[model samples]
Target chain A: MTKKTKWFANGYLTLVFVLLYVPIFYLIMYSFSTGKTMSHYQGFTWAHYVALFQDARMIQIALDTLLLALLSALIATAIGSLGALGIYATKKRQTRNALLSLNNILMVSPDVIIGASFLIFFTFLGIGLGFGSVLMSHIAFEIPIVVLMVLPRLQEMSTTMIDAAEDLGASSWQVLSRVILPAIIPGILAGYFMAFTYSLDDFAVTFFVTGNGFETLSIEIYARARQGIDLEVNALSGILFVFALLLVVGYYLLTQYTAKRQKAGVKRP
Target chain B: MKRKQVLFEMPYFFWLAFFVIAPILLIAYQSFFNIRGQFTLGNYATYFTSATYLRMTLNSVWYAFLITLFTLLISYPTAYFLHYTKHKQLWLLLIILPTWINLLLKAYAFIGIFSQDGSVNQFLTFIGIGPQQILFTDASFLFVATYIQIPFMILPIFNAIEDLQPSYINASRDLGANNWQTFTRIIFPMTMSGVKAGVQAVFIPSLSLFMLTRLIGGNRVITLGTAIEEHFLVTMNWGMGSTIGVVLIIAMFIIMSLTGEHKKKGRKHND
Candidate 1:
């Protein structure tokens, strides 16, 4: 607000940012170092990065992680969006509220609880633990988030549009594909991305549900980290860091573009 | 349309009933039974009667509370500061960006920071102080926990403060309110919802922090989360693990109730 206060704020903000970024900077620096220990900086080398990419196990795990995220996110988004639509379509307020509260169980429950329950349930079902269990677990937790994301968007949409589409003799399927889907596409996309990221970042849930030679990146990182970390892990993390940054930037740009288009459309109309 | 809606919801409803509801029900079921399939309250009895288990739960709540408290204290001012800054969006983005990075990576990075002969101790040594042990201590654990939580706490508070109309502050000023008075009477009360939301976000996750308890705390700090992990993974005791899981669910609900999130929703409906 004032000059002195402005300077003070800048100083405080800088310190906070430094605290946030310095550890990450340290990790990135060590990833390139030829040394194994995190403490020292040795001759610069790309050996860690090379090893990270070249390792068959790491490559497989990375692919598995991506595949799991994609599949789980897709399944969750589909079911969740439909669930949102159905919940919205319900005429009775009581049923809608009941369904929402049911959804909140998955949303609020700790991952450990979810993970443990899933683990026991799968064990009980004699499914054991592997890709299927992990994927199911991801979808189970992810659905609620997707529903929450899409529900608000659906609620904001004017019901008159749907009514008009039906009145115009459009089939239910046609109205869904052409009208409802198009109107809530952004929410669906948002839900998908959120679900995907949650799947990718998840550890505890995956940890509990994964066994019998299955591994995701987080699980692998946890295992390796417990044995004391190697620089290859740092290399993997650096690459993932860059990937996440790019994703965030892309999302930001996409939102900005949509906002601009919306504003332009409003002005034109 | 209603029939079509039901058709669409059928698969999801089955999934929720089986995967979402059934698993929690399974936990509740397992918690009541022992390994021999005999119905018993042994799990709950063990949790409530054992001093060690009770202490672990207390530690979980205590550490989680401190983490939330420290995060709020740090983030509130930061959010308030960012609310006035010109590049508020950019600053907010910067704050939130790290959360995109995996929690494990961030925790791993802090390992380097608090390690012996690491940057922190190295800096202390540079300042003519002895190299201090920062790793595996309560302080390091709390520090890392708070670090991970800051962004989550900041965003909500920032949004809440930003949402406040400047006219309200001006009106308070016009009525002869000083900055402190205005902040106390208007700003703090209005932004409390955000604070509660932030606390909920940070506090809930901090409760079940398993990996960090091992990596950062070095097995020194044992929480209910780590205990659950131990019961399920190490001991192969599903009943005990399920019991702990059930307790955590109840605790989660209690926290939700304390935050008054459901009550707020009801108030909004009434409005």
Candidate 2:
């Protein structure tokens, strides 16, 4: 906690950051290394990025990934937020425990098992595994994660705001829209981002649920990876890395800002 | 929101039932059938009797244990750095951005860097040391596993450390507690749940991971996931695949239950 120690902490933090990013930096550098060898930096070129753009299937797969991620996030967020509200509204102890336990199963269980199970489940029920089924399977696993993320904020929400609105002749619907919605918006947004990231990098469940002739970006990456480090895929991955970084950075800032504001309020009072 | 919400969700539930639920149930049912299609534990017996299957299960368990252990070791210092630093806002972006890279890509990147004439070897040769073929070895498999699981360990521990009240640590130190004493007695105990949660988060996924083995382990390291993939995808042996998958699930459930019980006991003792 001294000045010297704080400076030491600076060095420590920098080292941690380097360890985290060196692998990624290595990837980006070698991605443009102008070699079919996939290693050994021969020279520099932008051919990989160009090749990535020209591959017609890359656009389709990108669209598939976005559509799947967005649809899954929307459904999972709805189920999770509503379920959290229901828990808030009812406040039944046994119901709460049961819901939480179920949520944990959905959240923490092995993705491979869940994916495998769903694959078999669909085949047994004669459901055709396709892009649509992939989205649904994504939701089954994701809704619980959303609930876990959002429920704590809902529980902490003050009832006074809702009652205050109702006391002024506002309907229940009006109270929900005018009071509840605004309060939970940040938490809901956080849940949405979590769902989006989870769905974006997802493979296990997607592997199980994805059917004949349908490929998302991750699955396509898997097929390419089997052959070797194709530089074009590296460029594509770099782009995804940037996008996910933005979402995570946004989530971290919003959460920290809220926490800091709360601490400031506590100090004042 | 409503327009898209209802259009997407109504049929989606039905879609989940057929795709997600039914396949899981079918896998469960397959574990009980015989060649005659009569109900029995025949599949389970066949799987258990095969020594190769037993060894594969053990391999999966041991490999996952190593990944979780090593991931925690690497992540602890990183998580500790995040905990004590003020620049956590930017530092976390560095830590988490790599996690977004496709797992396969990371595995491939390792191959790119560690292959016989790869980057690491070339760099080593630039120094005094001779070249070593570290790729496709057990060490590489361990590296790949740890790399994938580190984020899981880091996030849970970091969250716990963030939520930690500074007052308790300060109070303990004020009472003449040394650095080690304060950390072990106060900090570690409080973060025990986070550590446990971290273990579960990393352990479960690492336990079931087969794809990394496939891509990077190069057909040498066989985990339960690889076995299941083979049974289901390669041989079309649904019955055997379900049996293996079921056993893996049961083992995971037991491990999770034990962790849950330990945490409850810890909380009770604290109370």
In CAPRI terms, where does candidate 1 land?
Answer: medium
| The candidate that achieves the highest lDDT relative to the unseen native structure | 1
Alpha carbon deviation, residue B230, candidate 1 (Å): 0.4
The prediction achieving the highest DockQ against the true structure is 1
Q: Which has the greatest TM-score?
A: 1
Model 1 root-mean-square deviation = 1.6
After aligning candidate 1 to the native by TM-score, how far in Å is the CA of A250 from where it should be? 1.0
The positional error of residue A247 in candidate 1, measured at the CA in angstroms, is: 0.4
Q: What residue pairs clash in candidate 2, if any at all?
A: A120-B23, A121-B22, A121-B23, A121-B24, A122-B23
Q: What is the DockQ (computed on Cα atoms) for candidate 2?
A: 0.42
Query: Fnat for model 1?
Result: 0.68
Task: Kindly list the per-residue Cα lDDT of model 2 for residues A1-269, writing each as its tens digit.
Answer: 77886787678667766665677777778768788766767898988889988988898899888988898999888877776666566457777676566556657667777877777777766789897779877877777677677777777778887778978999766876788776777778788878887888888778877887788887888888887768888788677777777776777788888777656856995
Which regions of candidate 1 fall more than 4 Å away from where they truly are? B261-271
